[model samples]
Target chain A: MSTRLLTKYATPDESGQAILKNAMEKLDLSARAYDRILKVSRTIADLEECENIEAHHVAEAVQYRSLDRSGWAG
Target chain B: MLVKTFGAAVTGIDAITITIEVNVTRGIRFFLVGLPDNAVKESQQRIESVFKETGHKWPGKRIVVNMAPADTRKEGSAYDLPIAVGVLAADEQITSSRISDFMMMGELSLDGSIHPIKGALPIALQAKADGFKGFIVPKANAREAAVVKGLNVYGVESFREVVDFLTGRKEIEPVEVDTDAEFLKEQARSEFDFADVKGQDSVKRALEIAAAGGHNVIMIGPPGSGKSMLAKRLPTILPPLTLDEALETTKIHSVAGKLNGHISLLTRRPFRSPHHSVSDVALVGGGSYPQPGEISLAHNGVLFLDELPEFKRSVLEVMRQPLEDRTISISRARFTIDYPASFMMVASMNPCPCGYYNHPEKACVCSPGVVQKYLSRISGPLLDRIDIHIEVVPVPFDKLAAQKPAETSNTVRERVIKARAVQSERFKK
Candidate 1:
């Protein structure tokens, strides 16, 4: 998806935003990883019948980015 | 006198209708024109033999057959039926007015028998769209072409039968199919089930998410971790194929000449696993003729690449664009064709060269940078396209020996279908 569509559909609420910001800093996620995480979180929330993405959904989506994490094999 | 008939040329997954125009002139030769390839050009010899065997005399006067939209290269022996039919009608041998009302496609055998041709489904679809009253295909291709409703599909066994049916001398039944009923009946039969596997619930969970969101995934595991087994069963847990998807998948398989003679439509999702030692042409599809490759064959299904690092670097390099656009376009000197390749990619790799990197019990024998070197075979750009990465370890002996019954793939599939329903609703504009 384009960056505009990603921001429009997958952007989470305030507290979810805080969780994403913290995860971005701690995990050193790239912008690509960030967009993917948002999309996955949106799916996770949809799975749970949640209209908005929750913090738990974002956390679960972050776990899926294992390959993007540097030094993962070590 | 001039007579017209119709045939179809399958280009990529769709078919283009070719109008065969035949006229008799004063000379004593036959001419086949309109950029026909060698296979199509060779149909004349078979036609001559078929006419003799069927007790019909070959036309001696000069005859010219022109396939309209001549820029499109007609590249198969399937044109034999149409050309032969048009000639007979033009020469006043078969005085049937029904010649112009249908599309005829088949390879004529020397014994006057009609041979099955590839891409019958796409050709029939094109004929129906163009308002043809009927489609005449070889008996072996009848069921495949009959899946398209609102068109009479006649399956003829030999050239004599075609002549008799067209001349109103013999009655031929048009094939009929209840595509919806057949599709529903076949939806419940899956070859593999998640319940058959002993353990690896975590990996199954990851695959479940991948199915629901249509995400690509990779698994890193040691040997004997059941990666291939899990990959094979992924299609079982995904939602059942809708009728439209079944048709789409069937068209790709039909153009690739992969469908069996009797199977009208594909009931189950396809799972294609090409070995790592495949060429770029075989993997992503490009050759002198530009046939659909493994990716196109794997359309609307899972393409499992086992031992991902073992594949040639150039092969993986060629797949990046198709992975992004979900369609592979091949540009030749004369024409460019696009094949749909929207498959969910499932790839597996060992953790390192020795298959023991970060293993709980195994000691790594490979020295320092060797592990990194082995991992570098799969380029980073390809990895970026994959959204889910999950690690798997061999099931412990206790887990393997446990008597507990695992959850069936059907049960997981129910939830996946529900999730997909939500996704479609959310995305519906």
Candidate 2:
């Protein structure tokens, strides 16, 4: 569920890429995992009951992958 | 038909009561109101699954969950258990009249276990403040919420457990916390004593002054010097948090999801050591929905930055305000969140890039100009905020090999506690 949230909103420029990478390695996830991020974005859209995914929702979904965007100490 | 339950909404470190109103009607959809975030809004699916898994029929009718008063924002999954239970009771799936006096909270897993949630301290405190009779949180968070007085705190591991307790089929005992006892245990002895550190009496003296005045300090030294180790021991000497201070500290940590849940109140001062590569936003904290950062977590405690110059310039710059103001104000478009960050800053950096700039035993590899450039990475203004500056030199071979029993952490802590006591007494007046 959390993965889908990451794909739709999180950008590779932010930490989301690293978080996605780590989850992929640790949990045997695939490109299909991108669907999880999309799902997360979808859920975020649903939260607002908006007809489409907003820029802010996509931005937030990406931000949760903190380590990817900024090379933070894990 | 609709039913209402009470939960707590945490802002910064403070928690206020939020009314969760569930309405089931003859309609086609699920609606969650009251400005819920993604986590809160998606809770319907999780809660619905839990209901089905627990042998209760899912509400086929249109369900609307309105978190009131209409304008306030609600975040996190902590509201899941309460909302789920409220729906069940209201839908007549679980026949219970006893849920009225007891507040419940937890994140529902598909398989029926109740997952842990954050800010138990603030939520429990809010429950007590609102005159709620009791609270039921996840088992892991029971100890934390139990710290609040005048509230019966119960911990449940599964949706069935909560249902059983609420429906009077089974009874769940309330968890108890002894704040006084926890304080006494914290006061007992420290593991790292000042006596163990050798040949840096000057640094120790500087630390003592910092402790007395609650001032920030910086230690410049070569590699293998005890700067990092000394910073770790600072909390041992720091005065224990006052009851009010402890609660305040706990709230920030709770909101940040840093509290492990064993300890409710933070009697001991926090010592946060974020690595050098931290971001400006992560260091000071910022997002669409702002959360507490390393500085906020270090409230009323110490923030130790080792390899200080290695941190990004922008990241360190963000700390300048909080360093001076003793608090950080995160301005989001919707709301501004302020977190207390009145902590003693203890930073350590090598005199030069190679870390052998001032070593007597080893030759300095970096040229003279290089040393200045490396030091220049830390801005003059940031350095100015630090009240004490000292150099830590390597221990002499004789001192390192000496058989003398160094003074223990207990000895240093006594003096620190005494100095802190003096300061507290002064602040009281």
DockQ of each: 0.57, 0.01
Candidate 2 residue runs with Cα over 4 Å from true position: A1-74, B427-429
Q: What lDDT does the true structure give each of the candidates? A: 0.89, 0.75
Q: What value does the interface RMSD of model 1 take?
A: 1.5
Give the lowest summed-lDDT range of ten residues in model 1 chain B. B420-429
Among the numbered candidates, top DockQ falls to 1
lDDT of 2 at B379: 79
Candidate 1: docking tier: medium
Q: Highest TM-score: which candidate?
A: 1
- Docking class for candidate 2: incorrect
| Model 1's TM-score against the true structure | 0.96
Which pairs, if any, clash in model 1?
none
Superpose all Cα atoms of candidate 1 onto the true structure and report the RMSD in Å to 1 decimal: 1.6
- Residue-wise lDDT of candidate 2 within A26-72, one digit each (tens)? 54433533453444444344434454655654444433222122222
What is candidate 1's lDDT per residue for B1-429, written digit by digit as tens?
A: 899999998888899999999998788988888999999888889998988998888888999999999888999899999999998888888799889899999999999899898899999999999999999999999999899989899999999999999999998999998898889998899779999888898898889888988888999989888999999999999888888989999998888888887789998888999999999999999888899999999989999999999999999999989988999999999888999999999999998888988778888788758887887888888887887888988898999999999999999898888888987876685
User: What TM-score against the true fold does each predicted structure earn?
Assistant: 0.96, 0.81
Taking the tens digit of each residue's C-alpha lDDT, what string does model 2 give over B22-119? 87888768888889989998888898788778898777788888888878798888888889987886677777777768777888898999888878
